[model samples]
Target: MILKKEHIQELKNKLLEKKEQLLKESNLSHSIIKELLTEPSYDEVDYAEVSSDSYNLNILREKQLVVLKEIEWALKKIENNTYGVCEMCDSPVGLKRLKVKPHARFCIECREAFEKEQKNSR
Candidate 1:
């Protein structure tokens, strides 16, 4: 389907919003790390002492970085007029699906398949 100008605008808006939100979150994480560094924790600050919740924080930060990369890639796809096209499959991912997951590179079926493959490979 030929993506309309309005649809492109909507996606651009969403991408911009996502990029801004990610930047804000990354900035917040940087601040937290900086603050924690300056305070000089009385206890060891290794990953072990980082607390279970903070371990999740590390995972979250890693996920955020990956999301940021995907967002940037999507922005590039928009520029190249290939947004909503699956990378693993030469299929036009439905606009409805894209609306729900703007950063998605594959449709649900393909995504699930790839995820399963990744798990198996891992």
Candidate 2:
């Protein structure tokens, strides 16, 4: 089904909001990671704790970067008038799914199959 103009605009707004939030979070994570790197640890325990925190922050930042890229791609699709279509099956990604994740690239069936394939490969 073709998405109505209003629905597309709504989804665009959601995507933009999420992108902005992620960018802000990424900046904060960077600052924390930098601080953690520059601080002097007083003992082995302290050093280990700092290292663990830094690792976790880096992982979170990496996840945010992936989502940011997806959001960018979704925004571009919106501009190209091809938003809300599944990348794998060329079907509508359903308004409910889009509302929950505006950057989703596949319909539920395709997404499940892709995930199962990924798990089997691993």
Residue ranges of candidate 2 with Cα displaced over 4 Å = 28-51
Candidate 2 RMSD computed on C-alpha atoms after optimal superposition onto the true structure = 10.2
Write model 1 residue lDDT over 11-122, tens digit each, in one string: 8789879878986987756455333333122122223335588687887775666676677778778989988888767788878988887877777889888667765764
CA lDDT of every candidate: 0.71, 0.76
For residues 78-104, write the lDDT of model 2, one tens digit per residue. 888888899878999999999999989
TM-score of every prediction relative to native: 0.74, 0.78
lDDT of 1 at 111: 82
lDDT of 2 at 54: 74
Off by over 4 Å in 1: 28-51
Name the best candidate (by TM-score).
Answer: 2
lDDT of 1 at 9: 82
